[model samples]
Target: MPEDLTRTARAEGQPLSETDNVEDMYLTFALGGEDYGVGIGGVTEIVGMQRIMGVPDVPAWIKGVINLRGKVIPLVDVRLRFGMAERAYDDRTVIIVLEVAAAPVGLIVDGVSEVLDIPPAQIDRPGQFGRSRSPVMGLARVGDRVTILLDAEVLVADGDLALPAELEA
Candidate 1:
């Protein structure tokens, strides 16, 4: 069995360890060549890239929309949302389906990384004001690399896409 890093305090109210605590799992992915993570609690699923029908008069970041099963959901290319240069989609491209505020939205990423359990102590606040202005919540240290933890709720909520009310539900 995998080691459990989900317990913070013991029965006696003492922490399990000085450096370890309950960790929230995150679904990691790549965007603009950098690794980013989103809390797994909101991730509904990860699907391979599919055809996205274009819509007019929307932000450039909004790639389009996809019909997931019987539901039509909007898709956002995270790279474009971050003002990064767009690259052609390849085999590594994927769409991370997330449920935010009762709406299902897909985030287009370069690729999907492994899920990680990162303790709160391992995440640090973004140092620069510019970083704070972005949708990222914090920077998490996972092994030897630093992963950008995104505020998925905020990212989806703050999106300027114009979708029908039925789809937003």
Candidate 2:
């Protein structure tokens, strides 16, 4: 959690701890032309795009891994994971690091927007429209902007993609 994010959350009267109302807080980011969000709880930190060392025998979406601090974290290209066309990484590109299933994984995104306090009343669950499973947890509407809320666990643990054996706990 960044200082600014904490300040913003506090200013908005949103709780930031496990025993509080953390469920309503989401870290939003830009993906392609739309906005997407993930629960802030699992997010460890956000970092600028770093060099991704290539690895063998992994899905294309698994862009590779990056060494952060003393730990190597596997990077997942969110666009490719969602079956979207690849785009060149730019200055705005970032990696949202998360802890899923007790393992560290990084999600490469277009750019991050902001931390929003979206209450349950503002979110609409994604019912069984067709797909058997979806990464989307719900659709959150903040004023006129709608953000697709994604399940971080599902995003990283999708059927077609699996982290390298060493990356798993």
Candidate 3:
């Protein structure tokens, strides 16, 4: 450690304040009553959930595949993936376009919320959400709500999550 820097911080008592360098936006959405966020850098676009072709061999969490602008992207029910009780779809339902683990997939969320700019400083440290297991990174503030910032790496199940045929490049 540099002697000059260490002396300055010691005088200040508190550790150096970290800067919040938010590079991009997040597509905030909901599952059941909890708010969640997906980094928008990988997002292609958001679309309304439509007729999905069901595949039987897969797990129930894999709701089906949606025909998104002629491309067959698989849809996952976020509520079911988290083992939460799900309700019937309504007008608020939306399919969040996500480019996760190199795949351009669509996640079926209860509803689309808004595009949020969550600064790194405001984000809370990793913690448990009751006994519910989460594959997300941690939580961050969005107005009065604390949205779980999902790790795109585990946003979708590995078995079915593959890069969109067009996005493979």
Q: Across residues 48-158, which tens digit of lDDT does each residue of candidate 3 receive?
A: 769887766777888878767667788888888888887798888988777776666788888877655566766776865553445677678655668888876665754
Model 1 Cα lDDT, one tens digit per residue, 1-169:
0233232212223334445422477778888878898887888888888999887778888899998897787898999888899999999999999888887889999988766667787899885555445687899876677899998777765566558676546
TM-score: which is higher, 1 or 3?
1
State TM-scores per candidate: 0.80, 0.84, 0.74
lDDT of each: 0.77, 0.83, 0.68
Model 2's TM-score against the true structure? 0.84
> Candidates sorted by TM-score, descending order?
2, 1, 3
| Model 2 bad stretches (over 4 Å) | 3-20, 159-169
Span of ten consecutive residues with least summed lDDT in model 2: 6-15
Residue 118, candidate 2: C-alpha displacement in angstroms: 0.7
- Report the error of model 3 at residue 69, Å: 2.1
